[model samples]
Target: MQKGKVLSLEDRIPKIKEHRRRKANRRLIFLLTLFFLLIACVVYIQSPLSQINQIVVYGNDLVTTKDILSVSSLKKGENIWKINKEQAKKNLMAIPEVKKAEVRMEFPNNIVINIKEYSPIAQIVSEKEFLPVLENGTILNKSTLLADAPLLINFKTGTYLEELVAQLKEFPSEILNAVSEIHYDPKETDKYHIYLFMNDGFEISATIPTLAAKMIHYPSIASQLDSKVKGVINLEVGSFFKAYDEEEEKSEGEEER
Candidate 1:
C-alpha cells in the first residue's frame, strides 16, 4: 500500500490540541453544574420553605387539636424534616382519651396528625354535674353530656364503679342506648347491687358481677312484657317483674272503686 498519507506533525499537533480543548470544556461544564446544585441544596435547607407552615389534625373529637399540638410539642415554623414522627405519636398516645395516634410529614411544609379516641360509655352524675366516663374506666372532667349516654348516679371512683364500668363496656350498643340511668343502690347483703332505668319505661335490678351476662338478653325480656305497664325487671338471682307500688295501688283502687 502506498505509504499511508502520513499526517504531518503540524496537522497532528492541531488535532490533538482541539481534542484536549473539547475534553477540558466538558469537564468544566460538569464542575460548574455540580457547584450550582450544591449551592441550591444549601439555600433550600436554610430557607423558610423547608420549615413547617401548617399542621392539620384528623379523627379527633373528645381531645382537642390544641391539646394534641401541645402534647406533641410540634410548632409551626419548626423544621419539618427534623421532627421525630415516632416520638410525637407517643406523646399523643399519652392522653387518656387518645386511643391511637399517627404522625406524618405532608411534604414541603405541612405536618399531619391523625388520632383516635376512646368512646364514652356513660356519663357520671356528680352533684348535678355530668362527667363523661370512657370505656376504659377513665372519668373525664365535667363536660357536655351526650344524649344517648346513660347517666350513672351514686358512683364513687372505687372498685364497685370500676366493676360496673367493665360490665357496661361489653354491653351491645342497642342495649346500652336503651339504658337511661344506672343507680348504684348497694345493700349490706349485696354490695354490688345496681338499678337500671330503661328508656322504655322499665327498670332493671342486677348485681354488678352478673350484669353483662344477664342484661345481654334485655331486648328479649322487654319484648315479652306488656309495654303499657311500667315495672321493675329484676335479674337478681332469677328474672321476674314487679310493678311499682304506686302503680299496683292505683290498679287495686281502680278495681275496688
Candidate 2:
C-alpha cells in the first residue's frame, strides 16, 4: 500500500466548524417552530373567533325574541368559555309563559336556545272579564274575544274555578270544536240544565259533569234534527230528545174537543 498523506490542522478545523454550523441552524429552526406553535395556542384561547358567535332561538310565539334575550344573561359576542348553560336555562324557565328551556353549545362558534311556551285551551268568563286558561288549569294572560274559541260556563256551587277549567281542558278536541258558548244558571235545580250554543246556531241542554260525553255524541244527535224544528235538544237524560214549542202547545189546546 502507498503511504497516506497526514491531514493538516487547517483542513480538519474547517470541516469540523462547518458540521457544527449546520447543527446550530437546525436547532434554531426547531426553536422558532416551537415558539410559533405556543403563540398560536394562546391566540386560539383568547380570540372571540373561538367563542360563541351566534344565539338561535325557537318555539316561541307570544314572547318576542328580544324579550327572551333581554331576560337571559347571555349576550352576543360574549366568551363561550364563561357561559353557564344551566344558569341561563334556569333564568329562562323563570318566565311564566316558558314551559321548558334548552341550551346547547356548538363547536367553534354558536349557542342555541330552544324554548316551549304554554298554550291556552279555553277562556273562563268571570265578572264580565275573560281569563285565558291553559290545559294545566293555570290561569294565563287575560284576553278579549280575540278568536272564536268557545267559552266555558261555571255552574258548580262552592267549586273552584280552577277545577272547572281543568275539566274543560280534558274535553276531546272534536267536542270542543263544536261548542261556541256555555251559560251557567246555578238556580236550575238540575245542574244538567247548562245550555250550550253550537257553532251552527243549535242549542243543547246538558249538565256540567256529563257534558263532555254528551258532546262526543252531539254530531249524531244533530243529524236527526228536523229542519223545521229549531228549538232545543235536551240531553240531560241519557239519549232522550224533546222538541217543544209554545205555539204548538197553544194550537194543541185549541184542538182539544
Best prediction by TM-score: 1
Candidate 1: misplaced stretches above 4 Å? 1-37, 245-257
TM-score of 1: 0.83
Off by over 4 Å in 2: 1-41, 126-130, 142-144, 153-160, 188-193, 244-257
Instruction: Summarize candidate 1's per-residue lDDT along 90-183 as a digit string, tens digits.
Output: 8998999999999988877899999989999999998778999998899998577789999999999989989998999989999999999999
For candidate 1, what is the total of clashing residue pairs? 0
Model 2, 10-118: lDDT tens per residue?
8799999999999999999999999999999789878977677889998987578998887778888888888999999999998877889999898877888999987
TM for every model, in the order presented, reads 0.83, 0.67
Provide the global lDDT of candidate 1 against the true structure.
0.92
lDDT of the candidates, in the order given? 0.92, 0.75
Candidate 2 accuracy as TM-score: 0.67
Full-model lDDT, candidate 2? 0.75
Backbone clash count, each prediction separately: 0, 1
